[model samples]
Target: MVAPPKPIPAPPPVKRAAALVAILGGALLLLWPAVLNGYPVIFSDTGAFISQTVVPLMIWDKPWIYGPFAWVFHQHVSLWFTIIAHALIVSHMVWLLGRVVGWGSPRRHVALCLALAALTALPWSVSIVMPDVLTPVAILGTALLAWGWPALSRAERAWLLVLTPIAVASHLSNLPVIFAVLVLALLLRAGWGVVMRAAVPLVGAIALLLVTNVVGHGRLSISPYGSTFLLARMIADGPAQRTIAALCPERGWYLCAFVGRLPDDADEFLWNQTSAMNRRPDGTAIFLGGREIAPEAREIVMETLRREPGTVVMLGLGNFLTQMTRSGLGDTTRRRDVGYGVIPHLRNGFPAAEEARFQSALQQRDELNAWALAVARVFPLVLILAAPFALLGWARAHAARDARALGLLLALLVGMTGNALAVGALSGPHPRYQARIAWFLPLAAVVFWRPRPGVIPAAAVPDPARSHTSPG
Candidate 1:
């Protein structure tokens, strides 16, 4: 027999060096602005940092619910920190993707491209500070847990399982996404052993929350005072609703001038009345509480929805869309105000110019939203192009044969799609809501469509002799 062919050499140092440069270059490009800008480290940032640091330092009260953490910390923290955290999280996600797709593969390039696209497509998200930072990290972590399942040893999978709860606990919105990924993993037959291994951490987190709440708050939930406060507000503001109704139906065009500019108490009162009248006879409202609804406020919104389901649906859709497109570097202004200890004073002060500026910013945000919608409408085309190539790469890598990789692909598809639909349907298609899903779409495409190495190109496949030949 011919002398054993020399084993194909590994990638030369030059190639490896180039790959490292590309990866680092991509990461730096994505992160440079945040570093230069001082990273939003106050307000939301401070709040998140506090939640992560202080709450753990204190008793574990309130289960670390997203609500309590936000409520307590939002006031004290800076939006800058939120922005910085988000940037770092996104960078981490990129690094994770590089590892999963094989650092030097074309798929890795695709991941880089997708990550870059996400930065550009949702610049507001990348640059801002909010719970939104958790979006990519959660999505990527879930995907990695699924995709890398087969390749992972038992110990590794167990570690991922433990990490899942932390991922979910980081942001409430991540719950549905994580749940979706877990469900898909089950369907793909990742095996019960793997599933349980992943769930241990989540279970431990919940247990910890329960113990904390009992010790710190004397109740299971964080906002025990919220209901009582809400009731008091309703009592205080009850008459405002009746007044508005009496005035609006009875008053003339003068009402137009005073609609949104009404006093806070008046608005609260009317909102409550509207909510009360719309409740079911049994006294339960359509939507649940905990999202800033006073008793009266709930009644007001319920009444609107009941009276005009169609209108409510339309408006909800509009709001959702608007929310998705709007960006605030996670309450940056609020954080700065607090950081400077001017929040209390500013709240009492009435700056007409600032108000005007705010209104103008709102108008600009709406315009940007319109542009985002136009872009989103054509997003499917991009998916069509990128997905196939990624899939080709996956196939070349025998991705399906590897349970971990396969599971990840399935999880990402299902979780991302489910989240997109859920947000669109329940919340309405806001770009911000979509932003969470949007950021992951390109990565999915890259993971599925990037080309593999060491495989014969399609062009050579039909020629058996040529196919057998190695790349020189």
Candidate 2:
């Protein structure tokens, strides 16, 4: 009764080879900074992750996923493999984005990757051996799952379904970022089919974390030490200090012993070995002792909220606003002196040969310090100036009926805001906290600037009224 449907043609071998070359080149581009440094970048938290992998023990604060991830790639041999994995994974995601936006050509993919490497903090995140790189990947993956599903090939869809959950499970903060994006999609009426499809990774991530925790610690929780972080945030922001001062004589909390002398910074309160929580009056250091008072910390946080709700809200809002504008590279790129920051952890986790290479790295020698500091000063200013223009571009894309671009823009906006709120409002605002994900802003801008017209696959463009059917 009808003619047979036409099958989609495949790329020729020459084009396929070219595309493969571009992906490989893009992966190398992502790793250029680390190559420049002569060693993979390390952060203060890098050692914690390394210890978790080498010793194969769980830390109270961070999730156990990244440690095993590192181990799987590195095989306890060298950290370079882990960083290389970061590059390859991100490059593949970039290529996937290109396909969704009707620019799946090798040349375009290479150009986009080059632009991102040069303009954004993405290279820095990739070079570093931390889970921070996964934040953007998870966010982007969720967007693709929600609105770009129809555009993706079956194999690509399967890859994201597997990769997204792993990315989400890599960090505690990522869970909230993914949830916020999904919620925003629903609020924008992305439809139940879209929301449910996007939510697959979120559910899988949650299940992975719960199952891992239950197996490791006999606890079915996301973060057993979460209360300590909340307490640290409250104390740093002044509400917990006020709460402790008022409730001490009545409640006799453990934190009362050093009421007036507590460090006013959340990081110091949580990680400074010299702080009262970590060091006793006898001067014996109990690094990260906040874990011991976690239950009490929860009580303190609840009481602080009950007593000073307005103050808490105001301070949290202040932190969130500050975090939104504080993206920079210095914190992640600066030199960490021996016996301090990441050095001790590296020394403890790796063999002498590895440590020798690390000691001679550009970061340890302070060779890139000035450049990093300069970037720290300029990058945030650039982002602040670029925000309104980015919004305008997104509006233009929406007006043009470019749902693929619109979906991506929305994902980056929501993910960045969620990251700020989750980290800044609760943990405290740090330049690195925002810098880790700020790359998405510039990446979003590129997508807006370069999208081709009338070339996006019809199936890829979401239908506003079609809420009943799900894309494969």
Candidate 3:
């Protein structure tokens, strides 16, 4: 007489403990930055972002998507929800990294995540209130979709779709990074045999951007400031100086009137209220036509480049290189002048009893900035080495049919390079821009990293059906 097979018993205590540590410890690590700050740290843009939820208005300098989201959390629950939600995303990446490595067991996965939490700057991404934290998350999600989609479960695929768009919509910079990865994914599909729908998330992000803009800014464009930003960078460099020197009297461009007053630093010109952009008593950007005629700014940029092509190339190269090497405080300008700027006015909108939450971070800005800089010095070198190591692993894999192995390396390189270009090119070199996602360089390399004989690669088990599938 036969009996139905008994259901398998649940995993034992040690295995359960390993899983719990992986999740809880990983979250605490992600939340470490907030813990250090005494509360979720606020950037200069925090008030503006929160405005979208409270005032529901669009900001010219930053995206509105994050504002409403954090606003909802700040109002309905607590601002801590913002930190909690962010930590969850980072923890998921730690889990996914473990899965990709094919670690021998749960304990191994826990070990890897703990190592990353302790060694990498990932917590900064999760701890900060800005959307900048999502940059690495987006790159990792895109790489997973492109390189390991076949091995992912159905639920995982759904989450990828959700995560990627949130990332792309979170910031204008993310769109370029995601798009570059998508293009790389297509190349892999065509040349390496990988199969996955890379464009769905991108399209979703673009659509979301348009919709959010329409709702907030009353427009369908990505942002009204692109041309202005580019123009600002060009003006900061030498080309705009030369162009103004030759054409100001003949062309009647407003910048000609204040050419001698311009600063050599581009960011200062764009961000500092006393800079040349405020040539007019009205406080409008004369070179940017008050930021209303972006096309005119674009024309000036092109004219400058046409006149001195080498300057554009050199400026871009310098900006990219500078950005790659540094990591500084996110909103130093706001911290320096918190006493009498827009903040006191903005504080009026804070939820009751939370008006003082950001003061601690403000007071300790110098100490924290120094702490970050010290930690940051090592990351650039680690990131710089990551690409070559990935190439080395691909070369050593010796498994020619393994498209997944090569695709991963390519995705990481393209994503990081794209981030550098989008941020440094359009916004100019600021260490904070590059630091947001540079850690991915070394982290991604670890995912596709190869181990020699007798040294088992630590990652998740490969699904039997996917073992023979080409990764491209």
Please name the candidate that would achieve the greatest lDDT relative to the true structure. Answer: 2
Off by over 4 Å in 1: 1-25, 32-85, 101-123, 149-163, 198-201, 208-212, 221-402, 421-429, 450-472
| Candidate structures ordered by TM-score, highest first | 2, 3, 1
lDDT measured at residue 284 in model 2 versus the true structure, 0 to 100: 85
What's model 1's TM-score? Answer: 0.53
TM-score of 3: 0.81
- Scored against the true structure, residue 292 in model 2 reaches a CA lDDT of 77
Query: On a 0 to 100 scale, what is the lDDT of residue 448 in model 2?
Result: 66
Error of 1 at 294 (Å): 8.3
Error of 3 at 195 (Å): 6.9
Better of 1 and 2 by TM-score: 2
Please provide, for model 3 over 1-472, each residue's C-alpha lDDT reduced to its tens digit, 9 standing for 90 to 100. 5552232233445544454456555577667667766667666666666666666567766777777656545563346778767776676665665454453345554555565555566666677667887787777777776666655655556677777777778888888888888788776563332334556667777888888778766878787656777777877777777787788777777667776666778667766666666457556545433355465666777789899888788888888777666554455323452334335434666554455556556334544666555665666466667768766666754365456656666676777788888888767877667767766666656665663333223223222123321110
TM-scores for the candidates: 0.53, 0.90, 0.81
Cα lDDT, all candidates? 0.44, 0.78, 0.64
Best by TM-score: 2
Candidate 2: C-alpha lDDT: 0.78
